[model samples]
Target: MADITIRLYIGPSSSDLRELVVPAERPLGDLIIDWKKVYLLAEQDSQGEMIRYQLYRESEGKKVPVDPKKSLRDLRFQAYQELFLTDACHPWWQGTTSQPTTTSQSKAPGTAPLRGPATSKRVTTATTPNPSPSSRPLPSFSPCSIELAPGCVRQIGETGVVINRDYLLRELPKSVSTLERTLMWMRQESRLLAVSRSDNGHCSIVWKQSWYLMAHHPVYISGTKYSRNEAIQIEETVTLLLGRDGWPITIRLHSTSITR
Candidate 1:
């Protein structure tokens, strides 16, 4: 039999989209498994994770399931139909799927099987204002010599306290914006990561490879610490450093006197 080709779209309906092609004879379930591996969304749970998918005929409004038993050739799916797949937590919007009415309550409420952890709460940190166009660029300096002040410190389980904000505006590089863009890229590249709070009290944006810790209190230091008043500056700086380095750094608070 001629190799059949199947296209897959993985991500939010709005943005951060991705695509891949697979053998047409592949089972729908196996295709989803392959996608999760490629995207790093295959988080394991006691029960296997559920993946929701939507398969459509090219250019047509209607959607149909890509059954495992049925070959893609049999489905007569067009050259390019919209195919969306995401971890169970991020279910594809099934406009075509009908929801059973309350009157037909065969299953108990909340008894339905869960796919993954619930969607994370969105955090809306205030953005720092952009510098005026007339502002002169600062001279280049080594990132190592620039000592970051300890940010807000919240104790972790027992041995650790995380520093959140550590941005220093005056010392920051002109290329800092590039760092922000890089983070946006990282977030898209790694969809499994999410914003979470560590057991102690530290808040961070986490991914498979690293976590960006946030300050519990603004940090104030020059030479020794970056100023705390510039919350946006600190966050942007930390984000840039972590994103670029591809390694995790621990922000520590030595004394409780630090201001929140």
Candidate 2:
């Protein structure tokens, strides 16, 4: 069997994305350890308490907690999938298992811009009628969504941007930069969500879906919903794009396997 590919966005921001390649049979716990090493997170207990990490998979527009024991293939994680990594201790993280525990003086390397998510709890004090202000839950952050720019979307060379098909096909002017080709490739792979090009011409694509296409030569039909004609057209476009030379691009391709 071959390996699988997935992308990890350090946070809600698109700027902190990183691609990871690992064995398809690898356990999620091992993947987490790899992340810790890459980010230089300390394994030693934080403060005086033991620190635990939780993994999450962003699916159907929701953050689904992942079990460390499950393998990537066991979880049915498709290629080009994206996952979010956050400390389970964050005040805003809904996955909190208990009261927040403080970490050691040395913070994790990939510090979040702010505390994230939201959840609630009830505390009873012998004499107090109201929960103290400090005990209240933090406000929820913006719901996770794809971040796209307005007008002709410019592609960041290292981290290619995702755009809607309608915008890419009609609104986006032909350009030499990575945007046009990136958009074309995304559309071919069914990663580009189609939307009306409004005054701003700005729209959101499934971030996880976008990164998957960039990392893998997608073959499975489950990752996308497309008509037979659309699929054929996409293949044709891909052929045309690959036929021409001097495009000056580098992308990773992953192996494939059939699940039982």
Candidate 3:
């Protein structure tokens, strides 16, 4: 069967965003299984049983419920399209798992910036405990949601860091040099998580108390080759795994070079 990856964006309209990757060919019912394992959203019902979830289509700014019996192949989504699913009844604000916004900030000139939803809330140690004096979780960093794009070659100090090439070539805007620079800096500063090759030659990372997997396509850099297909495979594996948790996975091209 031809392999394909589906990128899923999760979280809320205000804050808390995450991404998941799933196999395009999988049955729609698989999304719930994946989400629960990855995000830990599956809470026990009154009888102490895991609750089921339903997937929905967000079309024309309205949420239309969908049948789990359908195959994702039937949906025929374009790359980087938005899709959503609903879990058991939770607060409206709490239920929102993802939101898409313009890369640029929405701010007025010559004015103090508006505080995000997280900052506006009364500080509670139960929800927003201080990690440290210098380190606190930022609203932008949702471990569940990921921003997928083609990886780019960036210079960090003396070393060069390369991300998925197809993603940069296909998804990233050519005019966004500043954004690219910022991303490079984040990676260099270790603020951005790395999915490097492990001793087993697999790319993976531990996220949200679980081990999520990754794969890199082979690209030749300075006569050295990195595997793109392998990376894609790793991403596919992650999607299938996350699907068992009742969540959707989002995959964007991180590199173009299949053999570089």
Considering every candidate listed, which one attains the maximal lDDT?
2
The TM-score that candidate 3 achieves is: 0.33
220-249, model 2: which lDDT tens digit per residue? 222232221111111101211111121111
TM-score of each: 0.30, 0.35, 0.33
What C-alpha lDDT, on a 0 to 100 scale, does residue 50 get in candidate 3?
26
Better of 1 and 2 by TM-score: 2
Residue 260 C-alpha lDDT in model 3: 11
Put down candidate 3 lDDT per residue, 55-126, tens digits, no spaces.
666687766666665666667755555565544232222312333442332322221111122123212234
Clashing pairs in 2: 80-212, 92-116, 92-117
Model with the higher TM-score, candidate 1 or 3: 3
lDDT of 1 by residue, 1-260 (tens): 45544445443332324434556665455455445445555243223212333343323444344454455666665554456554343233322133322233232222222233334222222352324324734322212111232442223322223322232222234354246446656775421122122342223322111112333322222212212111111212232232222223334322222121
Which ten contiguous residues of candidate 2 have the minimum total lDDT? 228-237
How are the candidates ranked when ordered by TM-score, highest leading?
2, 3, 1
* Per-residue error (Å), model 2, residue 227: 53
Q: Rate the local accuracy (lDDT) of all candidates.
A: 0.34, 0.40, 0.36
Predictions ranked by lDDT, top down? 2, 3, 1
